[model samples]
Target chain A: MAIEKHDKENSGGGRPVAEKGEHIVARHLIEDDNIKEEKNLVIDGVDVSGRWNTFIISRVNSEFDRSFFEEIKKTVAGSRINRCWQCGMCTASCTVTPLYRRFNPRAFIYMMQLGNLKELKKYIDVAWRCVGCYKCSQRCPKQVNPAEMMEALALVIKKYFPEEVKTKLKLDEEVKKIYEDMIIGHGRLDLAKLHTYAIQKSGRTKELLGKIERDAIFKMVKDGRAFSVLRLGKPHNWSSSKEAMENYLRKLNTIENTEAGV
Target chain B: MAIEISNRLGLANVKSDYIHTAGRKLEDIHERLLELEAKGEVKVIHIKEENKPIEAETLLGWKKKIPTNKLWHHKSCGQCGNIPGYPVSLLWFMNQMGLEYVDERNQTSCTAWNYHGSGTSNPVGLAAVAVRNWHRAYELGLFPLFHCATTFGDYKEMRNLLVENKELRDEVRRIMHKIGRELVIPEYIVHYSEWVHVMRFEIAKLKKYDLSSIIATVHPACHTYKMIPEDCIYDKDIYAGKRTAVSTGVMLALGAQVADYSTWYDCCGFGFRHILTEREASRSFVMDRKIRPMVREAHSDVCITQDTGCTTTLDKNQWIGKAMGYTEQVPVMADVMFAALACGADVFKIVQLQWHTTDWRPLCEKIGIDWKKSEEEYNAYLEELKAGGKTVNLYEYPKS
Candidate 1:
């Protein structure tokens, strides 16, 4: 009422669009994504009308996420979840936290500790943002190891919503297939092929022809990097380790299958 | 426990006889190096922080030491696999300094990579491998110096676990025994960088090329400095702190302006297998937290790291920034390579400049390294490649 009165009193044939939230004073503070503004709105005999019919969603988290905490704590990486004491040291020391506002290690720990799954649900997209820098673990006063905790978060989120994670993550199967085959075939990362393949995949083919890159390629050829690659060659007699890894994978699959069954 | 058995034999216990002291933390503690040395089990050198720039001969204990003798070299898979120059650079500097060392091919990979990457490889197998490698080193009477920071970090953690925890110790011992190698703890566990830091002054004196113009930044491998902070050699730049103690000291000694970037302490986002399973996360880590800060904030020319994983991560990920239209590049190289470069090691033969993912040519320009000479030599290798001839390696050297 006050905004409408003020806009009418001040408007000397001025535009109404400039008066964005004529109904609300703190309109500029709310994000467009969260704010619901309907023009020419009328609901159930109520004059909800226009952009003034704005609804600012509450940002405050109301619930805790303990089940998610337990889920994380059970994982080998997050076994130390009990050690966090809500000190913001992990967040302060986090490498990712500065780059991203939502990647708060301390808040995540507190939310997980208190079972604030509702709040955590909102962060599912950014949950995998942690790069596993381990700085949080090194500097954490409580040794919470938020680095691996992020890994646990990634796993639990994957487990919680498998289909969502698969679609959201969208692993480049072709890239992974090439990567795995090289590792399995050579028992090493195969830097030359890996380098070329990664550059090619990123669509930076033209960059390869640059003077700096050409020189680096020449240097590698002259230097021992190329010789070592040639010298190390492929894995000899890799059957035993291959069999062992296969067995381990099979056993792991079975366990995961049984757990999912529950 | 040894004293209780000695009491029955009327054996004279030397431990209680003397109160020897060396200035260190827990100063004047009983059974110091004097008493410990008498036991013949281990030797301890009580070093103090105030005693800066101490002689290499004065250092003692396996936690951190300066070994000026023949040492067995355990090459890291990542070092050999990712940055080819890393091991050779360290070896070249050691040779330049006339410090004797040995490398072996029969030694199996530590398998720490497999364990940390996928969690499938067992610690028992790794512990046995460590002990077996130690036994081989012991046979040659040389201490094992690991090139891989993770290996050093992992072995240290494992050694502590194997010694303190009786169950794991017995398990590892059984595995080692089955393999016909007895479990004997190494006399000293030290990363290769520690030797570089200890010998920084000597390296500075012998510097043929000044690196003061080159803006080099250091990333202390998380494993070396943080994993087991107590066992890690240096704490701070001068004396102490867990952040990263050694790399900066060597960088400064080489006369390079050490750039203190915001994320100097941040991991390169290569958490063992973390990169393999989570490339986006790893890339985000290196670029967002590490690379962006270094390039945008610090304007670093070249980044130096002590660990192989870090070198690979930073050097390789710069291409990501390049691809994304952020053309500024930070050449990542091992600190040892920088030091070797200063000592006038053949850029191609000794430092192995070719293997790095990032073109260090630009950084080389700033550091008084002639790009043209290196280019000419590289063309020679291209000639070999063009002729389809066998490249010289482990065969051309003093030994494979």
Candidate 2:
């Protein structure tokens, strides 16, 4: 019987021996892609197939680039990056957090502080939804001014995650172009024109005047509210200011394009 | 439960420690501006008229002098473009009270909606625009009263930046010089709602409609108070001085049931850019955060706010809610417009409630306003206009 047991052990078979993958503790926790294996393999004249070659790509981050922090600190909105103590006050008071559980200002600031661009990359979609209410800034005990920091986050994302932003977010180019033209052309926003543009862009031009909207427009026209622009006209002395604004805008575009390597 | 208690206590301790270490209360921009004024570092346009003074407290128990007269109306583009009645209603109130103001044509829209919404303009551009507007007000010799909360907040931030950063001051000053204007910051950046708040009693005296049965919920515009929180007016009489007293103060003074709800601090979901780009988010946010709670929790008859965007969002987004089968919705309007309406201003001509998309007729009828009669009168007025008749003027300036 001892000889027979020895023979079984030498043959790589024993009474109730463990299977290849049974040795892996908490197998459910390891993702399928992460668990490396091969159906057949040889290394140094040895087969290391199946669970023998299993390995996990380490989820632990190994790099911290503090230069990103420095880049953010230079911005007017993010000048106070050093004041946050990770108290979660900003997140608690965040208007976006209630709507999007992922849009946590506290976490964003902490990640910014730690220069965790890898982790910050995950939040590109929801990061722009801050709404700029400043409730977080109001309630922040540290006075970190997380509202402005969120703006800083926007700049950083635009700079660092351009590809992701391009794919994930859609710029209302037509509306934005109209806004630019109006702000440059008249020195103020024409909501009437913008509303028309919005309706047209949304393909709701057919429904431009819903039953209620039609009545409202009729009332407005009758009351002369529809032609208010004709009455109020443009801001006084807007031409010179518009020239200066255009000059500044041109200079700004150049600087931004240069920074973006455009 | 024990963990939560410990965590809360720990947080409190940390906060107390932070405050102790900081060793000072947050500086009020007004105080800092006064110090700068003493040193001739900046120019401040003071409230120098025969103005009615109201005692309102800021967040840190600081007193704010809210001027109720001699105002320069800084009109909102959105208010002027979409809801013309917003400014007209406020102007009508000024006319009724015999207050002095300038509805100046030179006043620009502040362009903050563009800045906040599109992120097109930088801080320097914004600050330059702000100082230019302030200079215009100074040129007129009147106190600048913001008609829009977004402008008010944006100006507050611009003021902070100008006060702290000399380089920015130089840049803005250069831009101002380019426009042939000087750097002028207002002594007190007042909102029209704060004006309504201070004059609530006088408005109550002029109140023609009984709002006793009207249960109103106030959506404090986040831009009005949340931005530059230290400057906003809070009264102990209203919400124990915890909440802003602008809209709620007016409602309470006019004898309305000012109901409280869970999401009072949430944004109206105008969301600036979100309103333009992500319309669904804005619409859904207003519905879930504001409309639903006002309906379910507060049982409100109306949602009164103090900003143009808040009014528009709260009023217009109800259709989105209705499409989503949210059958309950409350009428939304500016506090001053509601006050004007309560003071028996012409609904179609002055308050111009007809411009609103929602069915505010039900709300008007609830407050004893005859919608049918008002419509008939409006139609008749239109006919008269068509027949080359002169329209009603809120203010009559004496010919020089």
Candidate 3:
């Protein structure tokens, strides 16, 4: 274990700067493959006319139209991705990868460079779990925002996947409802009401009610516990004054507007 | 609704009386076991039972075990400046417990508050702050002791960087080396609660006053909960036994009725920048989101928090809520309340019970704490409140 830990520390060893000529040669080889693929497709006369093909073409065109590649280049201007030399220091250092086998920071960058959107979307959930912790970002030999890139990929998934977007929208609405209720209800929380609302939104109200009843019945029938132990009720003064409620609402509005960039 | 039925019965909402009865039966059995133990029906092995106990020298030692020397002191700028007595209280407690530790002025604020709030400040800035503070501890030849969770977290981040990024580690070291310092990660970096709890048995010797009636609630800070789970040592079942993460454990040990409430673990929402830049969202999270529910549902007389930031969010923001029109005043205080209680001080004066809920002056008077003492007496009380010693003038601790 000690030897392995030591090896992990010295894994990348140090920066390995490639010669200018070697980088140029590698770039030409990549470009040559692109040309060869285009030529083969033309000669074969095989029509790649499908939904997947259309999606790929549209994604490529969108990137090309706004020079999205240039934006990415600017974001990682200080990064040493070009000098990466496939060191795998980032993957080794990433905490997320240990939990999520599919999340490979180095592989994601490589795929992004090749414009592989379909493959990127597969790990959208993994990206959303970044938590902006910056452990991976700090450890990156290339100084890449692996977490940010994951977030971007998650965004892309949200954009392209309609069902995911709808689910997210519903969750956001539920969150907003909680915010609104608190603001309008007198700058205080109504726990019972909030729990009820959350349960109803999640479509778990019936199940939750059942669980409560089962526990209460069991306690009464088996151990003869006091009935008072199961009380779940709203406070007497459930609502706040209109002015106080309004102030909270105003604050919520300001928060929403700020978050929305309005 | 079924909840109404449960509420009428004064029980936690559950399916039927069966489970509640079973739970009660289990409690009865547990009580019987305790009874048996008390009567010597159950023989318990013990290393030693003392016929006579030694006298405690300090007020802090009354409730906290003190190590003669080693302490992982986590730093907290907000508490140091705003509630200056909190650290002073700990220092006094340490002295009372005969613990030896070091507090270095050269250490910078964790800066985690700023970084967590604004994405603009990168890990490098946070790591830099951590390295500088750790270097100060190294210079003192003492382990770093962090009072605040953010400080502990920032140091943890620095430790990660040192382990993972050679370049970043080298950069941090170089920066410190230029200032004629070498940053050393402590063998242990801990929250103050953990330190106190670790010494609970010894500290139990100093309890002169009984505090069993004061109903209290622990409001664990989000940063502490999320950043360092291991440091929190509270048991969930026994409200009083719930660990240091919530700051209720010591309260429980002191004989306070620890209330169990939903949203007990919610963030007080004092993301420093959130309060300054996004005041509304911040206040909403605290007043509307966190405190209100706990106050109404928990049946707690006071809510104790560890972080000065959390305390300010819940304490100062209560006035903001009042101005906004929320009438429910729930007093929010710090673990200093526990320290105060342990010192045999009047509960109302020492706990700053007036700060708990708005309009608590009447409550303080009702509780027999003199609310209108002379300025000198008030300052002395506050000094004693912080130092966990006899009351002294406030200006004794030099201003930085």
Candidate 4:
């Protein structure tokens, strides 16, 4: 579904360029979206024309590695990965699927179960994009809990493809700061603050004054909800709770980083 | 609660009171269940063949069942903070029904929010917190009923891990021992909605509001239905061989008009961290999928849910939608709040509609409620509360 780019050129007075390898025999055998074919090109003063320079990227997926599936099965979250019969209920009810077609939970679970990490590797850009909505788990007839299964997928990807994740999902520093502050300071989340801060941090402050944004602000203010946020600040007697949470977070971060070894 | 076992089968002669078939305790089956989970067994359990509903009933209590003697009311942070009246309405109703209960500030939040959304706490820390909270309940001779569905699923999953896995339990025990609490899994852990469903008929008789005219829809919280479908109360209509949703059980009891709509089975989209990280996606899910459908398809007047998270999501998102220039706003309230409102509890003290973001004036007009007077009385009561005098509590005395 990611195929989009195309360059067209009329050549030889009547010959069709057939850009994107459409004229290649058994076109389905190659990844059409990824096919590399130049109508006319010169490399090192060589006449790389006609069929000489045309290249069809290999579309054939080989080696269904069950080792990754075994590794995933060992995890508590992905233990039920085998229950997916590819009914697509997970994909159907997925909240993120509607927004991003590549973030398909059913397909991810299938790839994880079959150890098709090569095929899955291509979608690394959208691999960790499950919003963790748990809608898939609810609608799944097999009780697959594809929601946590997504967590398992994320864990496996982080373990196997750390660099890819790092490059693809560039962490927004401002969103990270807002999250850290909200969770640590209050032992709770102020979604409104976090959302506004994230929008501001992303240099979208003008959207903050957009018609929808302004209308939402007025409505919240009119209903006393905006003021309620100040009154309902944080949990009372939260010093010890806060201490426990902070200690736990520190230890967890240490363990994760040590495992990541970055 | 009245479970009939075949007297001829001599189940009574068994060593334990728990029903056993083929000379095996239910815990033995649970142990095997743990093994199946470990083995990654894909075979769905044939309810009639291997372990029937009776087996699950042995682990989770029976239908029409609740502990009337005393209860350990574990307050949900989302409910106490966001809804403000949800937990108190539950306590208020329980006390009215002559059910002795304890609500302690000593008990902390379930700490499940992190595990689901934020990668904050580890498995051991969470197990320790859960056991610590329930151990206090056990000390008080009470069963714990969590208000949040996520907490219910968290407790169930954590308790299973603690009960089945020795290594995790030992780790948790070390933490609990330091906290001066022991790790003994409660016999029965449930969400508060279960108790409400079992007593729906009793609630129907006490309801003072004629709710027949109002259009209502229910969002059965995803965790409550999905986590342990066997544990939740089942209605023939809602289940239909699929997962049984609990809020509909509440609607059936209150004699409210049940609006059939799409997105009824969908999650409230409060993906804990999803909302924090992907606010746009979360908002899209709640508005386009949930709120808009309830408006267009069901013409829903009020959306009732028992999950504190779902309540917060559905109720709060309507306001967010209104701010975004979508005028169709539905008031979302906990099912117990609906029941309590129908039972003639004070709209201010019990329902606390002012704390809600979505305008509920339409619902008020539909229900023939005088919001202006209720608002004034609520303020006066707040003043009285500040002055250290007992204001009129709607259910202060036992409802005789």
Candidate 5:
């Protein structure tokens, strides 16, 4: 069976519609099937697969997916990901495959081109395992960024998966709060207290409660792990006065309120 | 002074700007050399063949191996404090070789990691580290031996100051007096690698086993390479020799087949501050380019290094790469590979040396290292590492 190239003009041109300081041309050109084949979808002088047109059209049609495909296409066009001719060099050069046979970088790109989001989502967790070593990208024959695509796939997973997104967001919020407290409140580290506060904020209350039953938590309690956490290192005597603290707090509150759109 | 301020703030962007400025200075020096060549003030002689007299005895000469009576050891704070076994391994190696070395607790750390990473580049701090270390060596009646490349480079700067500025010595003395410290000088301050290389014959006596089949590569620490180029004796004929000079030279001399590959001299991505602050950039340099190619393609079993920080980057960061899905695990070790071979340590113990500065028990057990007969101190250290569990703040602490 002969492969049929999907017409991307029906969705939108993958390229930018307007050039800088130039008038926008919204006119759509209709072409015959022969003319469509003659028009090259060459990226970086290499003809891309007809599958990319189908992928682009599918993305443009989804109500919430406006410009999502365009953003990915821009990255692909910029980094030359679509220029890949399915050369197995990247997969062969990849270090992860030898160790983890489940990780197939070439298959990932193939699935991406086919617009297989279900298969892609299944391997979303594997993307984080990429050390950004760039061996695949560096050795890529077509200069496709398998690493960047993996990162992009991870972002898509985080966006679509609500439960996973919530857990990660909570962790991020807790970490940010700790960082804010360190820089704004103390201006230095209090190792012991930081550990206690981190545990408390992370909802390890069950673990804290378990300590009461197990008797394993005695060393931590009696050793003043709770009280002395603030005194693990040299105490910084210098701190903002009450007036300065209030001023700082007001500025912080303003920033938070602005962030919350209040 | 501006550099110092940038460093204290842990501003990597500012640090790189200074590095670029230093690069420009080197370009200026190259321009001067070209200008001198053009002027006819300097005569350049290229002799195709100049016959020089070589003494018959010198060709076959062997120096008497004397047990090193005393050594003034310079400390790497990052390794000595955090990766405790780095100093311990060096001491163990020295003792096994019957070298008398003193670990002077009074000598403050070189502090080069902080100063250099911060972009402060304080000549005073570098000089203090040198003078203090040299004084410790003098008190112990031993030549100063530096384990870290930063300490070696600092001492080299101090040597320059001693020769070029008498007033600097007085300033050093004044600072020492204020700090209530003694100021001792050294006749010779050298890197540990250099000391080991020089005593190759003595080291040969200690090699009880051979690993000539195991292919190895050396990652020469950048501070050692760039700071004092003359002191980097290993990479001189790095590409030309059967084995690259420094890491391969020591390994080859101890009977290991060293593989020659591209990027042998590349930085291990532990550019002190770069590894700590700009982790992605640092890991990119190592995982993307160096370690992955050596392990996966070149098929080298191990990569050896001299500097403590370089060893840590190559070894500990292997896991980071695995977690990140960058590469398969490849064992990274130190020049202590030779020390392990010398002491008749089993392959397990040699592999254990892979984590010379950190906990090696997990690695040792993986490789089947029998800890039962090993020293109690080693076992205790492993236990501490297992229980004391710590997390690194990759964003907060600059890599050293």
Candidate 6:
């Protein structure tokens, strides 16, 4: 079968007019992620195959949607979104930005304020990398608290982009369980148990019982310092405090569940 | 707005200038408390009874009264768990100075690690927990001095939040009532480093070794100073009052050459959650961003910090770099641990340097201590302990 070629119009005799998707000049310039092509397509009972039915999403963001801005403003972490004036001070003082340039607080705040969900979605991986170091919040010119603003961004990302978060970021359930049990169960963290469990869960059991750790344990045992951890008992009157905390947490869960219409 | 302010004040267009111009209301918390106390809105647990007071200057030039005695030690879980020497060294220093302090066993972990690392807590719940702990200290008739930077910072934030938000105070009070405790907020939430900063002169008097040959670099814990910038201590003598004075002041007082690095503002990369889940990022960050710079740029002998997480991350993560064939390494320890070492405290029994992954022998040798003899003495002491000898404890509670 012979392929049919579309006739080129003599508009200016310089370059072909990019009317359809196939005539896109300098196609290499477009990012591979943005281009969507189907092998075969049929619309209105007409067959459109290969490059004839290609679709290219525009890279330039055209709309300034404020819906996400309203959504974030309701959060305590993002309440100060209105104070930011696009000053790069927060980004400049950021500890994580120097390492991972994609995790920019100033840029993230601007995206949330303008409701640029499309652009925000692309940074779901690096967005939650803020170390909660208040260097940015300490030096923010407008007192915007870019540190807490990062928290707001994390909440938004988790809510809107659940599938992306599930795939990209590994939420270590074992580590979370250990921390929760320590905090709620005993009201104190057992470092010995945490270190052991974390190392085992990370599949680095060799490091747990390695030469360095073994020597440390031997020294601790010899000095009787290892027993000190056992002697330091629980908080005084912790059971009642535990009960109150658990009750409060249960109440909060119910309130949150009702608000979510669960 | 910032430009207009800069133009009006004839100041350079810098973020610091803007930060100064846009004044924070609760910067002078004591002053705000005076007003709030007058209205009967909040009650402050005053530091009373037998205590020594030393005045330290905060960032805003506000004089903060740091009590030197009759202190209630709030131990850090990480310090107890990972770096046993941190608290032990501080206790040894206190014993040497004959400072009266109580090592309480009833205090709870601040749980800010879980809260910040994971969004598992709300502010109200956190405020309640902090208030409960402060109330415990009040019950003991002593002012609480935090051993963890995270707890110190978290309590300071909780204080501000409880004072500013009436509903938060009510909620916390309700929680407190449920626990059969009263809502008591400390007049000042003090970190142990601040106590060390104020006692540096006294510490110098008891110094047994020459630290003049040693060059030290400081990694100020972000939670200590940066979290509540206004409340942290700063001195004109230390870095012209530009940086926090807790870590550097002690080193300078002990006569060590305090060196500066460019990445002094960078975090130790514990990043709470980053340390747990994305550990490679945390390890790489600590190695590349912090340790390498202190070693190469400053030629420092040791990296001293005040926080447990900072010390642990900076100290333990260095060995991972060696596995990747990066040879540059520096010993990291708390300010009190180094100060305790200079004071001729036991290396293994008291300071517990063996728990640390990085090598501390070279640093000790540079400070004029015979490493081999100290290790032998430590081994003999361990043998004695195993042979039914009494364990050395700096302080013991009086029998009730």
Model 5 accuracy (lDDT, Cα) = 0.53
Clash-forming residue pairs, model 6: none
DockQ of each: 0.01, 0.01, 0.01, 0.01, 0.01, 0.01
Give the candidate order by descending lDDT: 6, 2, 4, 1, 5, 3
lDDT (tens digit, per residue) of candidate 3 on B322-350 = 33335566666666545554554444333
Estimate, for each residue in B47-136, the C-alpha lDDT of model 6 and write its tens digit: 665668788888877778898887889999889889998998888887777777788898888889988899899999899889888998
Per residue, candidate 4 scores C-alpha lDDT tens digits across B1-400 of 1121122111212233433122243343344444644565311111122110121232233332345446677888778788888877887787767766677667988888888987788889888888888888777656677888988988878766766677887787778778787766654456788777666777788877777777787788878878755455554344332335466767766767766665677888787885565443355467767888777777778988888888887777654443333567789998898888778766787788788988787887788777778889888878888999875655453332
- Kindly indicate the candidate among 5 and 6 with the higher lDDT: 6
Best by lDDT: 6
Residue-wise lDDT of candidate 2 within B1-400, one digit each (tens)?
4453333222211211111121166877787888888888788887764666666777677778888877888999789877888999888888888888888788777888898887899989899889999999888777889989999999989999888888998898888888899888887788889888889899899999888888888899999999998888876556656677788888888887777777888999898987775555566678778888887777778999899999998888775454334677888889988998898987888888888987898899999988788889989989999999997774444122
Clashes of each: 14, 0, 62, 1, 14, 0
> Which lDDT tens digits does candidate 2 get at residues A1-262?
0111123335655555434334455456644433433334444345444444443333456677778777777666887888889999999988889999799999999899889988898898898888899999999998889999987887778778878867775454345557867777787887877887877876788777688668877888899988995565678999898788666545652222223221
lDDT of 4: 0.68
Between 1 and 3, whose TM-score is larger? 1
Model 2: what is its DockQ?
0.01
Local error of candidate 2 at residue A212 (angstroms): 73
Which lDDT tens digits does candidate 4 get at residues A1-262? 1123234453346656655555544456656454555555544355444343343333445578888777777666787887889999999998888888788888899888878877778788887777887888888999989999887877777777768866775454236556766776677788788888888767789999999999999999999999887676777877687677666645652222223211
| lDDT (0 to 1) per candidate | 0.65, 0.78, 0.52, 0.68, 0.53, 0.79
Q: Which 10-residue window in model 4 chain B sums to the lowest lDDT?
A: B44-53
> Model 3's lDDT to the true fold?
0.52
Q: How accurately is candidate 4 docked according to DockQ? A: 0.01
Badly placed stretches (over 4 Å) of model 5 are: A1-262, B1-68, B179-184, B234-244, B346-400
Interface RMSD of each: 18.4, 23.0, 26.3, 21.3, 18.0, 20.5
Ranking by TM-score: 6, 2, 1, 4, 3, 5
